[model samples]
Target: MVETTRRYVLAKRPEGKPDRDTFELEETGVSDPRHGEVLVRTLYLSVDPYMRGRMRDRESYAEPWDVGDPMQGGVVGEVVESEHERWSEGDRVVGNLYWSEYAVVDGDDLSRVDARAENVTLSSYLGVLGMPGRTAYFGTLEVAEPDPGETVVVSGAAGAVGSTVGQIAKLAGARVVGFAGSDEKVEFLEDDLGFDAGINYKTTDDYRAALDDAAPDGVDAYFDNVGGPITDAVFTRLNVDARVAICGQIALYNEEGVPTGPRKLPQLIATRAKVEGLLVRDFSPRFREATEQLHEWVANGDVEYRESVVEGFENAPDAFLGLFEGENIGKQVVKVAEPSE
Candidate 1:
């Protein structure tokens, strides 16, 4: 059995965008699981934009990571040793585990993954069938609630959550428009994901004009993942009684100070738009329901997903930093190790 583990720790709080120096890799002795716990060997780790919030000294939906402490996020792993009856050796599971190669976690904190399930990969548990998927399902369907024939625009449309939101809106019989960072992402949204229109925000000189040209009927629902000038443009085109789901604000996640942008409340008031922030954890009680539906959608070809996987555990920090750079078309994950099966 492996006796040592390598983990990434928060070295310092990032002022604006986090760099490689923000994380420090440390090697430590692996400990055996005590009663009601299991030793997990990480197979894959998720790198999300939300983790940036944790890098700050302030509090948010996720607790701030203290400097010198191990950074944590969703991890899919195999149970190498178990002191809990519910878990056995070689069992595949997923949980909010540390960035280490191995971790001693309580059985209750982990959810068993059925590796035998058809078409399901271990990495999918950290992405499409996991938190990002759940966030898209609830945020679009529950928060945005786009009615049939309505025009729904999604910011960050090539991303994990944003892509899912656009597809869900399309499934609900609404016209879906998307704004992505690159031309290739715009193509993916339009050609592969069945979005009605896709705009390359990187290429567009006028966001409002591009949006107006695509969504002539106006945006009845907006699923915002990146909040910045693009979002400001979206606010201008909102139709009456529009619904906006504020799922993420990736655009401002790295700013050293609060960025001042165009005031949008006046537009919201004029349009009577309702904007509500979303956190997937709030829908935890219905996770199974969402997961089952998402699984079905993926299985039946009703939904599609992509993954940008970094090859090694050592590259986890790089994969995370890539989020702000829009390097991934969908979910960004680090392949730590293969399952022991």
Candidate 2:
């Protein structure tokens, strides 16, 4: 058995956007599992924008990573050794774990991978059937309740959560418009995801102008994944009684300090919009229910998803760094190793 593994640690917190220097890869001894814990080999690991917030030392929803301590994120792996009654060797499972080749995790902290379809990649459990999927599910259906025929706008529409939100809102009979960073992403939203319209925010000189043309009647619901000018533009066009769900703020995640932008408070008052922040952890108890629905939708072709998989465990930091650059079209993950099973 392998007695040691390589893992990434927080080498230094960043002054701005994180880069390779933010992490240090080092060899560490594999931990032995005590009672109710298991040792597993990581097969895949997720890279998400929200993780950038964890790198900060200030208050945030996710706990900060201590300098020089091992970094952790979502992963899917095969159990290699078990001291728990719930798992056996070779069982595939998923959990929020260390960014290493192997991890020693409490059995209660992990769950068996319930593949919703044949030939499904184990990595899908970290994407469509995982955190990002559930985030889109609840953030769209529950928080931004778009009624049939209403115009729903989603920013960051080419991303994992944003794409899912657009599709799900479409399923609810809403007309969906999306804003994406590139022309290719705009095409993906319009051609592949069935969004009613898509604007290339990177090229658009005026976001509000484009939004006005697309949503002539104004936005009735919004799922905002990118917060900055796009959100400010949407706020101006929100209809009375509009509902807005804040799923992410990738646009400002790397800003050294709070960024100054257009004031949007008065727009909310003018529109009487309900703006709510979506912290997926708040709905953890209902995760299974949400995942099941997302799985079924994915299985039956009612929903579509994309994944950008980086090839190796060594490139995990690169995959994460790419998130801030808008380099991924969907869920960004690193393929650490194939499951032994």
Candidate 3:
């Protein structure tokens, strides 16, 4: 009997926040792997804020997804069938694959996972040891460049990339402050992640004042994950020669038109600040190095991670939609299926 696969496809372009209508689920038969290919059974699928931009019809850093096409993201899976020299049956791997239960992919597109790694989970490859980890690694240490005793601020502090950025800043000896949406997230940042302060942005009426209270020395580095009012406030507190890494602009992702916010160029000019937008793919050549360091940090408990998993492949769309709702803490991933022994 031929194996079947279930997947989610883009139904419509979202004008604002996406709804259930934005995705359509489909069922299809999986094709046998050709030479130099493998048939993978997805174990976990990553849901990230950046996927929202890809839903639009326009081009950006990543190609836009076409309507009625299967959605794609980071997936960790087990090879159930293989016709490739480098991969074999039962081998666990990670790659950019469709939001499906199974997919046939080229051998070169998949990276083998080390099942022997101590205390590592398969989902870790989609979160802390994957794209988000690499993004935080280079964005903070390379782009933001926070120094010891300097104040570093991260927006969207509880999410995947932001959480890692704040913790990495702490490791660099910088005083880290984070802005999150809820009291629980604030607690996680300050108490769990060792941030100097975590402001509940939802409850704060005056963002600038709240940021001022948190960073009395002014922000020396800003790792911006959610841009808008929170970012506008952080710019006001930038110290001389401040560095800003624009990792994500989740606040504006769902907007119909370009979202407007407070003018920040004047502040940048006055502070002589440097701001650079970062994409993890830009540092692809050094992914192994970053992954190695992140794995070490995670293994030694020097860096901690949290995941908000939505169980079942059927709920993958729900998991993706939840990103704008702030439904996740460290990383949001969907558990598709259990690996076969």
Candidate 4:
């Protein structure tokens, strides 16, 4: 029988930026599954930038977590006990299980995951096969539709969504330019990830000049993950009829207060560029179709993925903090609790 459980609780809401002190470790007894629920033992907990928005008490696409509550995020788990007919014991699933040893979830929230599907690991379904993957897929194809031989610029080029977006753009015959935080990340994209060009944003003092040197014809599509000045730079380089798919604004997440804006409204109007924010959840209706296509590409070796796994349940908080520092190479995950042998 399951006994005690440990969870990382939101100890204190961050005034400006979050630190280790924001989370507190707490233990409780494992909860029983009710009639339409199942008990899942957490395996891999996903750490993403979107969680930063949830930390704020402000309203957005999702609800904010109350102070002193368990911090929630995407998780892949194994069903240990089940009172639901849809999920039997030993079935693996992915859902919003939070930062806990175990969670009793309603059957509706959990989706069955096959570890060996198309030779893809279960952890991948939480990444390239899941939300981040979908964000790259639909956001690029639907939001930022590019013609063959056009130029595509992607910010946060080494992260999960950015990396995938670059590859997808390349597959569609676009010349891809990537903007990343480090020389190492730039090298990874250019040499390893097959990007046509990569600019180290941190080292480069003038981003607009860098873009000018890299893409002389200007950018046709911009897959933006880090907003702010990088996006501002892209705006000045947009080709006629260019599209900017806004995915995330991670650049401003750490700031305590909103900074004064030197508004880019004039640039937007001058370029006549279409800028649309994309949420992967909005494309959930076509998720299965996209997953199937992605799976085929992966199996044929046309698509690739990378992961940074942190071992142990207790290390979840640190794994999360690593995102802000760019400590992770790709998608970051915490191996919270292992599967039953």
User: Least accurate stretch of 10 residues (summed lDDT) in model 3?
Assistant: 112-121
Order by lDDT, highest first: 1, 3, 2, 4
The best candidate by lDDT is: 1
Cα shift from native, residue 266, model 1 (Å): 0.9
Clashing residue pairs in candidate 4, if any? none
lDDT of 2 by residue, 117-160 (tens): 84356888888789999999999889999899999999999998
Count of clashes, each model: 0, 0, 0, 0
What is the C-alpha lDDT profile of model 1 across 150-267, one tens digit per residue?
Answer: 9999999999999999999999999999999998999999999999999999889999999889999999999999999999999999999999999999999988887899888999
Question: How does candidate 1 score on lDDT?
Answer: 0.92
TM-scores for all candidates: the values are 0.98, 0.98, 0.98, 0.96
User: Over 4 Å off in model 3, which ranges?
Assistant: none
Q: On residues 132-212, what C-alpha lDDT tens digit does candidate 4 reach at each position?
A: 888899988999887799999999889989988988998999999999888888888988779999998888999999999
Candidate 4 off by > 4 Å: 117-119
What Cα-based lDDT does every candidate model obtain?
0.92, 0.91, 0.92, 0.86
Q: Which pairs of residues collide in model 1?
A: none
Off-target runs (Cα >4 Å) in candidate 2 are 116-119
Q: Write down the worst ten-residue block by lDDT for model 2.
A: 114-123
Query: Clashing pairs in model 3?
Result: none
- Residue 155 Cα positional deviation in candidate 3, in Å, after optimal superposition: 0.4
